[model samples]
Target: MKIYKYKDSVYCDEDLSCEYDNYAGDLYDLYLDLKEDNKCGETTRYYVCDKYTGYDEPEELIEEEFSDLVIGEYESED
Candidate 1:
């Protein structure tokens, strides 16, 4: 799996065959909990890393709050 760090959150990129939806949900939940606990930075940041290539453009990353659908792209295999 590829780990991308954007601001305070880290996104994991996994293969298409892998269960990315479940993982994304889990990560979002974790992010929420962390935010509530003040574990995340004030920026409210997150990332979208590729699991296979472990590659993510700096511009592709997102931070400061995001929609569930927006995050879904990170989980996408394509």
Candidate 2:
């Protein structure tokens, strides 16, 4: 699903798919940009992934905060 940044909550684009129902919360690793892999290819821009699951909900962050939400290359190795 294509994720959207509006206000402070990041949510799955309602127009994208139902895999997420406009979910807006803490994602362990929220990829600000894109990542490529051998298996999934160019998938999962934002993920509350297995090993990367968050301990708490993310607070309202501004667009500038995207840098702080970085998901390292090795991190998204799902």
Compared with the true structure, the alpha-carbon lDDT of candidate 1 equals 0.37
For model 2, the stretches where C-alpha displacement exceeds 4 angstroms are 1-10, 13-17, 25-61, 70-78
**Top candidate (lDDT):** 1
lDDT of 1 by residue, 1-78 (tens): 233333444455343325433343233444554456554422333433222222132223323223332333443435
How does model 2 score by TM-score?
A: 0.19
Tens-digit lDDT string for candidate 2 (1-78): 235443444543233223335445332223332212211112233223333323222222212233443322121224
Minimum summed lDDT over a 10-residue window in model 2 is located at 33-42
lDDT of each: 0.37, 0.31
Best model number under TM-score: 1
- Cα error of candidate 2 at position 19, Å: 1.8
